[model samples]
Target: MKYDVIVMGAGHNGLVAAAYLAKAGKRVLMLEAADEIGGATASVRAFKEYDALLSRYSYLVALLPDQIIQDLGLNFETISREVSSFTPYKKEGKDFGLHISRVWDKETEDSFIELTGSAHEGKAWQEFYSEVEKFAQKMAPTFLEPLRTRREMKTLIGQDSTWEYLVEKPMAEVIQSKFKDDLVRGVVLTDALIGTFASAQSIQSNICFLYHLMGNGTGEWKVPRGGMISLVNELERIVQSAGVEIRTDAEVTQVSTDSVGVRVQTKKGDSFTAEFLLSNAAPAHLDRIRGKKSESALSGSQIKINMLLRTLPRLKSGADSRRAFSGTFHINESYSELEDAYVTAAKGEIPKHAPSEMYCHTLSDPSILSEELAQQGYHTLTLFGLHTPAELFETDPESSKKIAVQRCIDALNSYLIDPLESVLAKNSDGSLCIETKSPLDLEKDVRLPGGNIFHRDLTFPFKEEGDAQIWGVETDDPRIFICGAGAQRGGGVSGIPGHNAAMAVLAKG
Candidate 1:
């Protein structure tokens, strides 16, 4: 039997790609190494006496097209909206809320200037930021549309700009140049490194900042009501409705290709053949499998930790009790303190300073998360942070992975937590209290390398225009395309890559 397309790993992108293909009247097959979908856009069942929100609202929804939501008829409760967040700052008996609302714009801007004495400099900061925002708003279309063809992107840029012009300029310089205040500069620079491995000072991170603004999951993030998994059931409905086959516990172990197209060898020796293939599995997993297709064109990966807590934390004098613990909490106490954390991370060691996290997925829409927990009568939390150098795991990991985690928690206390005595330890190693999971742990289970969520770094060289970069989705093989985060525009709940890959095969095949 022949298939018009075979999509591997039913991740958000892969599902979207397959669904679109089937909708266009193509025979689409989506395979998953695991029994479930929704990769990092996932929720774990509680084993301990605590609570957890079924779905996190500060989701990768920004990358999702508004029309896609409407067309899918996915549950309306699955999509709710409210104001986004508050970055709490309490130090030296002072408490403040870096409210993420547009209303807080004036106060937030004023507080930073006053805190850093940036107002004494000039009005240049005001003019520069306005321009940056305007430029970002204009480029919104490029971000919303998936890159299907070089010709399509060419229209967006002029022939005059050089490749270096696109990359060489640093994002830190862009923000700092406008504002002489170091504190204000650091605050603006925080946006640059949010979902990346690069520091504010790192190269090409300015682009990462651009994408961060795109998601803007700000304004009280929301979860699709009922349960986060309701999204899976809805998507599954669409897939089945569109005639896409479903399989669970049906893990693909090998992928082979020839003049006859492709053969997906499953662990049970069950064989799946198709004319075209798209993989939603992590790049790390797909790259390490013992097969021809296992050589995923991926370079490196990242480490992640998700937790469910019994109760929220308490901050001392400088802390804001009422500060909205909405989505993500930024824990930078000082400039050198933030840099020291990154410097330590570069050395494959955790910094002994506040490494930035008090983040709860609750900020998106805390009441929803709270209500969900109340229904189950337990308190839950999901915390995400970045540590480890870009290529830290390039070589094999030494010793057990637990040592590295301890170092990450230690790094948090150096500055952010006062006296180091007040810090609440809630499963510091991600093992004692909660079930620990990472890209490395998932490798044996799903056959991924370092268990990287995106499967490749979206730092640079991939998202830039006029470049023939093959980071994730773009490949040279006739019937090949990447559907997971390791593909184009990686690592988010957005299903753009999957959607784009299907459209490409539909147009070219």
Candidate 2:
């Protein structure tokens, strides 16, 4: 069949592109390899015995633009978190932790002072975040518009020193120069390491740090009200209502482009042709399917663990368990510790002290659980372990996963009064309610090459020399475009690439 545009994947970005194209009065067809859409944004009944819906892959919402929600009239909603983060520490036979609240009050400041043993560090924390806020404000608006040159972006930032530190220098230097406390520096550097395998000392790490902070102009990672699936469900509705046809279990096998248009053939012997083709698959995956040589070296590093607990684990720090788990809970993720783990992982060994983060989704929104589960104090815990690269598991996938999961649990246990295993809920069959996914598992489940969550490592938002202006979704073939995380500024849940791809197609006239 022939169509105006053929979108090759049903990921969030592809759905966004298809929805916009269909709404613009074009006939669009979206094909998916899996039976359902959303790709990494899917929420599934991961533990059937517990009656809980876990965001199996992508867990938070921060990068999606408000303009897309308003333009599409999406029914999606996210709850703002009160506590921003809590990092626990052990000192001189006593347990203490630092808490950063959304509303920075005296308690937050006191916690920082106590943990760092310096009131100066507490003051520095405010100053550091204030600078980040300014950076977010300057860069957030550029995300929705066409790609700018480096010079243009620097002009918008308006401060030579700020641009030099944030954009020109390595992120490690910025964190070290600004924050005196190693733990505080770790907290700031964590933003640069999310899904990125590079060290904060690298220039690429600066790009990752900027992308993490530029979310929605606030850098606040909000929780979707119903779960990540709600966003996908709403986008599916918009696409269907706009008359876009969607086909699942349609694994595309080939994409051939000519001067006039493109042709797509699926493994099922079905064929499609369109004037324009949009690929939501990883650029490397698309190259493999299209019989072309791939150029990018992309891999994801992180271990994701989903658990259902009968109750919150008691923290040694004596903070309110609900408050501690409500936001990002850091485990052994201090600055020196993070650098050590990175160095260990680079040496192809899983860090003994795995730097990880955890949060209880039920603490913020219990809607994902059944009423009985909620009443029974059952909650969902999503833990993410950093610095465990995909290569660590290439030799023995199962053994590496087992070791990685146990190390993460052990790291979390050091901060808790009780071992994490003690509070885990059990199935009727006596199995603990826990699941772990390594980068290898993600590659198998979602086709994320090397399990890299942001596709290839993130790219700078500005255009480089010899690149197409405004849009970064263009490919070597004029009729073909990339609308997935591999594109420039195409990481996280943001629909910018999809939106921009459609805009590129519309501008072809």
Candidate 3:
């Protein structure tokens, strides 16, 4: 059946595109390869270890366009998360709590300023976020929402100055020049890896944090009250509510665009046709289909890992530390250490001492499970091992998986100064809770490119306004449009990519 639009992959971006179009009275049909929707934004209950809604997406509410939430009636599906990140750094033998969440009220701010102890710490926190709040204010509405031409973008950000200000100066250099403390610099530099496959040392690694920074237009990251998946479920409802049809287990095999429009062939011998098509899958996956120019824009791949724990980590902050689940525990021995890990991964080898970013949102929201597991002390943990070399699994996927999964256990043990005593249990194998899931796994499942989360090496430095990606609205083809994280503004849970992509199409009218 011919449709107004066909969204492939049903990832958050796909769903976002479909919903927006459908909301505008367009007939949109969303399809997924998996039995359930949500590409990376999905929750996998197939494994008991991951039964609860662990974060396949980020918890930042800042970058998400609030208009979509209100317009689509999303607040009913998603709960507001209150916890912000608290990174604990061990100095010498003592542990320090970096309470990253900003308490909105003046009274709480004063109390926190006092609790922070050092004047520098308090001011640094305030200052960094203050700048972020400023730039990010321009990020979403003015930057993220609109789909414009290169000339239009240049005019908006200022042609000569914007490139020099945003792209030319890499994020790493910004940290070295701006911040004094290595610890503070370390914390801020880590933001660079949010959606990029860049090492902190990469020419412009920290630039990805622009989206991270912008996400909280006000510079505050609140977790969803239930878990990260709550956002996905809510997004799912938005798609459903818009009367957009979604089908899981319907893997798309190929896409062919022509004078007759687009035909999406599924793995199960089913073909869906549409006047306009948007692929929320990774760009690498899209490459396998019948498209050339559209597939070249993406970059990089990733390795994802998730862990379920019996209790909050026992850190130097104290065995029962309130900071255990404050946000995420980024285990980095030193700045050089993290830089080296990224180097090794870039060469296609998982580092023995790879720096890990553990997003422990489960602790922030005690109710990760549907209900039952929440009653138990079972908390979910997201251990993101970025820059894992795709070649590591070339000969032995199992070995790489084992090492990749165990690194979290080993890293956690090192951080807490105690071994976990074999508490790691796999969800499916009943061995360990750590699982080695990568961009390859995602690509195999949904057909995204190189398993690159943002569909390719999403470098903001390269997003020139005239570029199809910069605006993320228009596609090379007349009717075909580029939406989703793979499009312009790139990854994170922000539906801006899809939303803006559709707007570009609708605006053509």
Candidate 4:
């Protein structure tokens, strides 16, 4: 079959690209290797014994633009989280923790003061985030616009020192200089390390940090009204309405491009021809499928844990468990600990104390669970362990996953009054209601190429000299483009790559 354009994957980005192209009157066809769409931005009935729908891989919503939501008339909704994060600390024989909420109140201030033993650190915390808020506001709009150089962006930021500190220097330098408390610094630096293997000291770490903060212009991470699957289902509705044809389980075996157009061959011995091709697969994966050698260094560096809990675990810090688990419940993620974990993982060994984060999805959006489960006080917990690089599990993924899950549970247990196992829901067969996906598992499940969630190490959002201007989705082949997280400015559930790829194709006329 022939088409005006053929998208290589039906991931969220691919769906966004196809929707836009078809809306612009282009005949589009999308082929997905998996039976379902959304790629990592999907939800699943992971536990058969439970009635909860879990956002399997990509859990939260932040980077997706309001412009896309409005333009596509998407029927999706996100619930705002009142509490931003809660990090537990034990010192001076007291149960203390830092709780930052959407609004600054006396209780939050008191928590910081108690945890840090200084009002100055609390003041610095507010001042530091105020700067981040301003920076996010200035940079968020630029994401949807044409690419800008580092110089141009610096000028937009309007302060040489701020630009140098944030964009040019390592995130660690800025974080250390701005915040003195170890736990506070870690809370801020955690943004820099999500899905990235690099330490806070790495210059490249600043890019990851910046992306995490600039989502939606306010750095607010939100939960989908239902689950991540609803977001994908809405995009699918948009694309189908625009007359785009979609095929599943159609893995592309080879891609051939010529001066005129491109041809995509599937493993099922089917051929698809199109004037243009947009790939939602990782750049490295695309290279392999096209039988080309790729030198891209891409590897995922986090462990994802999905658990169905009978109830929220009681906290050792004496804070309300509901509030502690409402937002990001950080565990052993101090700045120094994060550094040590990075160093240990780089040596191909799991850190003695893993830095992880968890959140109760039901706390924010209880609609993901059925009425029976909600009445039963059941909740879903999504835990992510940082600095557990792909190398650590290379030798023995099965054993590594078991050890990693245990370490994460142990780390959480330190901050909890009752053990994590005590709150775990039982499966039909009487097993613990918990599942984990290592980087290797991500590679096998999503073809992420080294299990890197963002496809490859993230690049600067702007284009360099002699780079493609069509939304930074262009490749060496003019007839082909990238619409996945591997594309420039692509990561998370943003769908920026997809929208940009469609704009690139539309600009061809």
Worst 10 residues of 3 by lDDT: 76-85
Q: Count of backbone clashes for each model?
A: 28, 1, 22, 2
lDDT of 2 by residue, 1-509 (tens): 46999999999999999988999998999989998999999999888876899999988888998998988889999888899999998889898888989878898988987887778887877887778888788889888788998888888988778788888899888789888888888988898888888788888788888888889888899899888999999999999999999999999999998887899999899999999999999999899988999886758899999999999989998999999999999888888999999999999999999999988899989999999999999999999999999999999999999999999988888888878889999888988899999999999999998999987878889987657656888888889889988888899999989998999999885
**Model 4: residues >4 Å from true position, as ranges?**
466-469
lDDT of 4 by residue, 45-68 (tens): 899978899998999888999999
lDDT of 4 at 158: 78
User: What is the Cα-based lDDT of residue 113 in candidate 2?
Assistant: 74
Candidate 1 weakest ten by summed lDDT: 158-167
User: In candidate 2, residue 345 scores what lDDT?
Assistant: 96
TM-score of every model? 0.78, 0.98, 0.84, 0.98
Pairwise lDDT winner, candidates 1 and 4: 4
Residues 1-509 of candidate 1: C-alpha lDDT, one tens digit per residue: 66778887776677778778888889987777676775555555434433444343223245565545565655534343332344444456665544343333565566555455565433565555444444444344454355424444334433223222223567655655566654445555555565456666766466566555554322123444444555566777888899998676677788777887888888878888988778777655555442435543332223454445444455432444334454445555234555666777677664544344444444343443446554542334444444444345435554324544554455443324342323232444444344434345545443445554445556431344556543336666666777766666665556656766766677665
Cand. 3 TM to true fold: 0.84
Clashing pairs in 2: 300-452
